[model samples]
Target: MSPHSSNDGGFAKAAGAPAPQTIVTDAEGLDAALVTLPGGAPAYVARPGEGDTYPIVLIAQEIFGLHEHIRDIARRFAKLGYLAIAPDYIIGYGDPRTAPDIDAIRAIVVRVPDAETMTIFDEALAFAATKGGDPSRAAVTGFCWGGRIAWLYAAHNPRLRACIPWYGRLDGARTKAQSRWPIDIATALKVPTLALYGGADPSIPLELVEAMRTRLKEAHAPAEFIVYDGAPHAFFADYRESYREEAAKDAWARALAFLRARGAG
Candidate 1:
């Protein structure tokens, strides 16, 4: 494991105690479990509200692994009447939380092959099925690095009903295993997707977003991108400095509506 500091640039320390806002109420019955990935790595799983079959929405983590914020996201979805699960796709890699700085996190992320991440997602889908999730109605959503994975997963899994990628980078220098960009697969998507982005995000320029839109239009993919004018990256993360409540709320409403339209709920 990489030597991690409790304080890092992109990653935050895990919450020591629950926050007072009360985003999810019926979360008592939900238990966290560990599932073995295809490569025998252990990944965390959070079950649905009442342990009943519900349409599943696979939650992907940010550069940070399954931290408190990501876990809360799963519970928040359960409160919305859907089964949401997030797996630790970076299980074999060093824990991002333990990394001493953002550079360490970035190094770990770069070393993680896209193919291996996708395989873990497939295992997450199988794990979701055991928790009473309807695989046929499964959808996927992700933030930051996870957002890029959301797009890749949509292309990889034809069974997906919908997808939402939040503030993920649209373009980057291609690696061997990460040859395909989102634009490359935009038109080949079988599932509908909604991409939420921040117009002010320097990491992901608006021009790239526009290029992705053009590709989606050309391919006739059921995909849409929304940019919040002044919001920066990670605007939806309330615990972070980039939180934009109004924009986050609006984007979340759109995401829920999009999922419901495609039968994810």
Candidate 2:
């Protein structure tokens, strides 16, 4: 692992503990087991070992790829009576964990086709369905880069009950790998999506955020964006200096409520 510090130029793993609200599981009944997606893709599954079938929460990884953080998020969902799965969807492109820097990760990301990601997640959903997860009670939530995918997934899967996109860009320059940006699909959403964003995120201008809001409102789409004033991007990442404790707390509360209200908890 890269020796990271808060002042690093780009992505840095949390150096030590005291992670804002780290939850440790004894791996008791709440165990996270390795699983394979329909196509043999790698995934980590977490659920209450003693309970009945649970709602499914499909977790999309950060730009950093599926790491301990994403797995922990799955474990957290298990505690909430939901079976969560975090798949290493980017494996076909490249592993973000080995990138050494954010720019390198972006290089891999820029070349990853959205269609491929959509299909992988679809297979992942199929895998979750077999693990006793209720497909009708399914939801999706992702962070940063994955947040953008959350929006796309909401549009792709008509069965998603709810979705939350965290600080994902509302608009961006398109590439061959990425034919459409989130803004392009605002009017195409079939499910309710709650987008949580940071007001001061340098990468995402407020105007784009407003534009996305306006488009969604005009389309009468069931999507909403919550901008936390003064918070930077990736505020929910407790291990990073960009984390905003107050904003993260409020975001989680709102997400839990949205999930529960949609029968996805």
Candidate 3:
């Protein structure tokens, strides 16, 4: 979805958000393209131009779905020598990329069941293995809408070496499609996770972040939560006004280190 699109009823882009600063990555050297997953879903795959095998990183997209920003994220991981695959996990709810507004995006999001998405991830990993991806050395990271799913995927997939979720929701009302939140899985998390949050994010309260932190500590889960003071939600989204260069750069460094430390690098 175009964050600058005015058709979103003012929900697509935050109010007073800085003028859109879309950053597009040139795919001049990387092997990047739109490929079909084993399950027939469309996905963006990016990797080094010449690699016998590379670590796998599955990128989860924002509520806007598989847009250019998300594709750029995959390319970023590819630059770090990863076989990054960003699948269109938001299937069956229509295309959020072209959705007229946030309400339309939200409607499709609420209907996406975790079970289906997890299964799609399973397929995506299998697809990766065919493209010189080492499944044993794999990680998962997501932004905004995908961020929350990253938490669940870390718990669901034991093979993942690391997980990093950026500004994902910690707690929320449960539904048939979404029966669990990050807080609900904190105590059971099995993979090393580095979670980044915006201290000023109005949608996600600091209290929930603290609660999740407490739960992880109590369970001795391998996870770290970092809050960037005064940073707004989606601070890593450079295309939007919420982007904070300092927080985003620091978080990116921490994410790469976390993944590499756990052998996903």
TM-score-superior candidate, 2 or 3: 3
Model 2 bad stretches (over 4 Å)? 1-26
Q: Could you arrange the candidates by TM-score from highest to lowest?
A: 3, 2, 1
Model 1 ranges off by over 4 Å: 1-26, 49-51
TM-score of 2: 0.91
What RMSD does each model have against the real structure? 5.2, 5.2, 4.8
Write down the TM-score of every candidate. Answer: 0.88, 0.91, 0.92
Ranking by lDDT: 3, 2, 1
Top candidate, metric TM-score: 3
| Residue-wise C-alpha lDDT for candidate 2, range 1-265, written one tens digit per residue | 1111121122233223346564344445574676678776787788877666889999988888777677767777887888888877787888787676777888888888898888888987888888788999999999988999989888999789999999987778888889888899998887988899999999998999999999999999998888999999989887666878899999999999999987788
Give stretches of model 3 more than 4 Å off.
1-20
lDDT of 2: 0.81
**In candidate 2, what residue range of length 10 has the lowest lDDT sum?**
1-10
Best by lDDT: 3
Q: Is candidate 1 or candidate 3 better by lDDT?
A: 3
lDDT of 3 by residue, 19-110 (tens): 46656665656888777776778888888887689999999888988876788788788887999998888956787876777888888899
